[model samples]
Target: MSGVVVDVRGLAPVQRFINRLANPDLRALADSLGAELESQTRRRIAEEKTAPDGSPWAPWSAVHAATRHAGHSLLQGDGDLLDSVTYQVSGTQIRWGSPLVYAGVMREGASQGQFGTTRRGGPIPWGDIPGREFLGLSAENEDDLVGITEDWLQELMP
Candidate 1:
């Protein structure tokens, strides 16, 4: 109710596959990969300054949400490697192709007055990636975060 709305129909196959995977090895592999991706993304986010008020930039929940969303989006894409593999991230909101996109959206939303001041003077710029108006997060940078999620797609797909 307080966050952006995303269409999940775009990721149905992924949701279904994850639901069906009973292999612990595969599950663990997926988890490990997801954690690595999350860690890298968080590091990049942390490199950015917090709001002018010195508060934390973006919430951890939001970052987690964005990562999960990115995984789901990748699952939904057309790639042979990801077709049968189950990859999921816990606790997320949006479902998109990449974390960069979610970060961009969060950055834009915060900039557009969506979060609206949790501390003192109102919401502040908390994300490192500039908004689309400022060139946004580039594909190269996004790849750096997740290492060509498209490649994961190929690996996951048949």
Candidate 2:
């Protein structure tokens, strides 16, 4: 079954950051920003116009295209606030499952010139570099998802 496997608890740092920035207005700003970003990303992703069978032109072609395009838009908005927040809060790599639904984050540095994978039980670039961001991967299972999310949250703790 498809659903949000990674619990959003790891997003506390992001929430904290936003809270600091907006202060008493934090909740309003965050709600507006989240809604805006989600709406925009969804609209951009919808432009693909997939076939009746729900197949793409090629493997990962649509996902990559949509992600790159949406990523660019997100980056260009508000001093890359969404991009930075996404990288810091979530991770830098995003992934798609089946017809739609994407996860992950884009890290700051490219190790060996590679963007890390979001796969569960896979090796990530954690603790390998300083000041680098990571993306969360949609785990293959719920347990794995929880583990990854918890790991990310711990990384943000002081």
Candidate 3:
């Protein structure tokens, strides 16, 4: 008795086409997008004068000026926080964040309270630190990321 044999020879082209969208290929694309986003965010943080909502950050306090000697410098102080900004990509997830402990507090703002003492031995009220959004994903940022991803995915089309 002869057994029937199935032929998959015609599927070679299709297999190759599918391989283009494989995890390794997609991961390469994800890495590229993550790097692009990290660069864009860092650039904005350094140069933007206003938040994504088109509002300025709170004015520097007298203590801040006295401590840094450059109250008008905007985001720059010792430059530690800005320098700590970095990004990482794991699998398909891209994370952009700062290593600084105060990064979140600085971006989200803190409630009014005597959290610390000033150099003049006065209480440091939290009202002096208004919530200023320095790092966030804006609508334009989202559009850019999505558009780039779509363009990258289109490359895998047959």
Candidate 4:
């Protein structure tokens, strides 16, 4: 018997892996990713109070805070937004977010008069609101996804 120097589709399983990568099923992958995103988003809003980039969210203006009920926290008016955090797995995609109308405003912020004047013709928001980002993957999240993907790929291979 002679020692073989070459291998086909069996050298570390790279070929078989690559062949499957072309159009691999995304359901499992999407589910894992979406779940993590949902958890992180809710944590960002309810616990960390920081953006995915690790920056602290802008503090509420004194006037605005005064308007809120006693002991209310940022972005937790009725706990609806945080409770609404959810994820969905679509074909080759994982999208997660809140369906509430103000979700975008909270994520991206708004400037005075951005949404047009109020009924009395004053600025709608009255004051500028800085973005309080609560969605996105942090460095830790990216790393976790990499590990998850590796495990998923291994599971996919025979």
Candidate 5:
């Protein structure tokens, strides 16, 4: 969602192929790519628990870890973030991300008190939170997208 932009209409190898596409076909391709990416995102949060590049997420701080309930892991509180991940296909564009307001900060992380203090004068974050990147495109993700695109193209072949 926050990565490379492909203009299939201009590229050489796929340009002619892409030109043959109706808007409906383009939309279908977008849907396939979107589904593949969303599945990767869900797996990242629910299973991998690592950055898209496969780096382990920073561990929860001791103070924060102490406050979590027994069954909860980092960012798994109430399952809201995981459930909030979604994607949409509009025209030939595939847009995907969480609509939740805090999603940006969670992905990029925030410095404690960077957003200012609460009414009680406490730090906004209450503590320094490390970034635990859950949404992104890795090499593997890009490869998967290419494969999906190839399959879509094959399906359109005469």
Candidate 6:
């Protein structure tokens, strides 16, 4: 699925250098950032909306809902998307994503496109699916992430 990226370019040169240092303790900073993003994204996914704007995600497509023997509202309703969410930290990089196949589709939404055929043997044209920025940060969430990272970094200073 979609993920979040936090830019650490604004950190003071000294701190930024520390981030790139080849030390185990310094790596904790990246891990802390990753943990924060992972937690927030999970929260947003559980809420089923973009964190920044609160935009609602499109319900499951009719075909998918029908095949799953689930009500329209039940598609992606079991919290699989939320459960699949995870994060990783490698040096200065922090990444988060979901293993769900439809995760990207739900996050980015689909455009109107023709499938092979409809039930009536006519071409199936999917409608535009609105994107839900669940992995994206709201203005306030952004502030919190930054604040949390800065605080973590501050603790690293002598």
Model 1 per-residue lDDT tens digits across residues 1-158: 59989999989887756654433234434555565544444333334334323344433445634656443422123332222223255543212224333434534543434555457665444433332221123354456536644445445552
Q: Which pairs clash (backbone N, Cα, C closer than 3 Å) in model 4? A: none
Ranking by lDDT: 4, 5, 3, 6, 1, 2
- Candidate 2's C-alpha runs over 4 A off are 1-23, 48-158
Which is the better candidate, 2 or 5, if ranked by TM-score? 5
Candidate 5 colliding pairs, count: 0
Ranking by TM-score: 5, 4, 3, 6, 1, 2
lDDT string, candidate 4, 1-158, tens digits:
88877756466577667767876878878899888889878888888998889999888999898899865788888899999999998876888999999899999999998999977899978999888989888999789888888998888785
Q: Which prediction has the highest lDDT against the true structure?
A: 4
Between prediction 2 and prediction 5, which has the larger lDDT? 5
Give the poorly placed runs of model 6, Cα more than 4 Å off.
1-24, 58-75, 112-128
- Model 3 scores a C-alpha lDDT of 0.71
| Predictions in order: lDDT | 0.41, 0.36, 0.71, 0.87, 0.85, 0.68
Residue 139 of model 1: what lDDT? Answer: 52
TM-score of each predicted structure versus truth: 0.26, 0.21, 0.71, 0.78, 0.82, 0.62
Q: Best candidate per TM-score, number?
A: 5
lDDT (tens digit, per residue) of candidate 6 on 12-90: 7768557645353756777777787878888776555553576666665666556674422422477778778888878
Better of 1 and 6 by lDDT: 6
**Over all chains combined, what TM-score does candidate 2 have?**
0.21
Residue pairs in steric clash, candidate 3?
none
lDDT of 5 by residue, 1-158 (tens): 69998776556756555566653378888888998888999889878889988999898988888889977887788889889999999988888888999888888999999899999999999888788899899899999999998988787654
Question: What is the model-wide C-alpha lDDT for candidate 2?
Answer: 0.36
